[model samples]
Target: MRSSLRPLLVSIVILAAASVGASSARAAASGRPLGNATRATYPSVVSIELLGRSMLYSVNFDQALNENMSAGFGLGSSSMNIHNTDLDANKSATFLPAYFDYYFLNAAGSPYVTAGVTLILNHSSVKGTDTSTGNLEIPSSPVMPTVGGGYEYRSDTGFLFRVAGYLVAGRSLTPWLGFSFGYAF
Candidate 1:
């Protein structure tokens, strides 16, 4: 992590945490996306994805602000350590993905487009030995911006699934695919 980006990252994390915490503390809080009073009765969703914007996997949540709009967020993290006769190193990363979607139809199944920013929180350091020491970082920026569209099937019975393709500005501008499964209520 770069020193200059720390404060910005911390501020964002703190503000988001506070906002989410406060919303969830409300009398009727039920994982719904905080929005105007009119949207309070809409259902919210919780899901887990494989190979999505989080890079590997993420636990995701979505709050339906209305029939055609949704607000979403996700959290993902990973750590790796390697040690051998000559090299030892460790790396860790955490990701927070915030996004929004617009469903084309107000039905049980719909096609949607999404746009969001993913905060990449990471650190990698190698223990220095008499022989060598090293430090590494990828996708140098502290954030990744993404846009994509896909089909989502959300049933009245609380079942939800989505298969999405995304263009993510990470490491380089690349295309990524994600599949998700969860429940809405």
Candidate 2:
């Protein structure tokens, strides 16, 4: 019984090797390379951004899934003073943005459109000369939906630049413009 099993095993192995060789030969004849073909891997980029209104600042990290799609997250803050009063206000927001880019024109520089949602946390305080109210502090938290588009330029040497505009929905729709510069690794 052991001798018979050995012959059967050798026959199975020989058949398997012949099949693999035949597949390789077929692929070669068809002009198609087989096994471990080269593929493009997109790099991740990190950046810091400054918003034009309300003095907002943010840090963002994005990664390319393919040539035309990327996704990222951002954290930002802003502060301002109210006119005709001694009141001050401050706000901070976090965003999850998804981008769809058109890379048809140029690979180094591409224009993209983005849509995102943000979780916004706002705090306000009033100070000075208010005997009746003294010092007052207010805190509010809300979720804001947003949409925007931008143009970005990235070089092979790691230099990066971007500009974008966003409309955030709240009690009213607020527009935000941002500029960013960073290095890509």
Candidate 3:
């Protein structure tokens, strides 16, 4: 009876080991850990960006159409300071940019492309030292079309980092670059 029980226990242990090896092999072939794919999906992110000439704070909502593609929209605004010491003048610009983004996902990080428009409202003033008049104020509003692209990295723990650049077409071609950090939920 003892000999028979020993053989049965050894058979059970061998079967368990084989099942574990097979499952691990399947996971290895897929190139993803057993439970990681499901944890990687986040539908929305909110971020604050420090741009080349401004500061933008925005919220974005994204939907993953597949494993490699995502579509999203973002809205943000910035109040930028434009200063020229030679002219003794200071200017401020307020911009509202609304855009759509497309993301390409990979094993390393995700890269994205964007297209958008910005409503720019600007105001400027000359200092009294530069002119006889105490102060002179000028204001203007322009609608500009823009396109941009960027890369984003999101860690498994929900921390995110992004770097992006934008080209705005107005009276002159203006380039804006930004870096942002945020959380994904």
Candidate 4:
């Protein structure tokens, strides 16, 4: 049983790494069809939230490789200066999220739905009590996966306006409610 399990574990790790490598390559190759393609769509989005003492803002951009696929990256950060009991104890955090999207319908200037997974890395700092009545800072790091869906409005010139909401599951550091605005190019 041990021998069989060893090979299976190795195979699983190799497959996972290969899958990530393949998607990275695809995102790079997606730009290849630019000149001959009918139009390349791109979207840029900005979002803001108000939840008690905590506030957050995020921005992301998407480039449409073809009619059915897209990839995007976003940066976000939040701060809690009020320090309420209900608020998460972390003073601040920053996250970088990347995702690849597949559009169900094929067409320009039409509404389409997308499905994708997001890889997020988070860095946080928490305040703690110090002996001298001063505050001490504790740092934390974590990574998580988020899945979501949204709608896109394509255009003839390859620029688009999109609105999407996704629930991020895993650590509750970031709120489950999130939105994206991007374009397909």
Scored by lDDT, model 1 comes in at 0.64
Compose the digit string of candidate 1's lDDT tens values, residues 1-185: 74643664565455445534443445254544333222224378887766677765689988988778999999975333353233323454577899999989766677899999988755223221111111112355677788999988764344567889998775557677777766666
Question: Candidate 2: misplaced stretches above 4 Å?
Answer: 1-42, 52-55, 80-86, 90-106, 121-141
- What's the C-alpha lDDT at position 131 in model 2? 11
lDDT for residue 62 in candidate 1, whole number 0-100: 88
* Order of quality (lDDT): 1, 2, 3, 4
Q: Please give each candidate's TM-score.
A: 0.64, 0.57, 0.54, 0.49
Per-candidate RMSD, Å:
11.8, 22.1, 20.4, 16.2
The digit string of per-residue lDDT tens for model 3 on 64-149 reads: 55555555545544322323223423433455555666677553367888776665544232111111111111123355666889
List runs of model 1 lying over 4 Å from the truth: 1-42, 78-89, 123-137
CA shift of 41, model 3, Å: 1.1
Best-to-worst ranking by TM-score? 1, 2, 3, 4
lDDT of 2 by residue, 1-185 (tens): 44523653564455445544554454456443332221122257776665521225567787776677777776665433343344543422233333333333336577777766555443223221111111111113345566777787764444456777776554456666766665555
CA lDDT of each prediction against the hidden true structure: 0.64, 0.50, 0.49, 0.41
Candidate 2 residue pairs that clash:
none
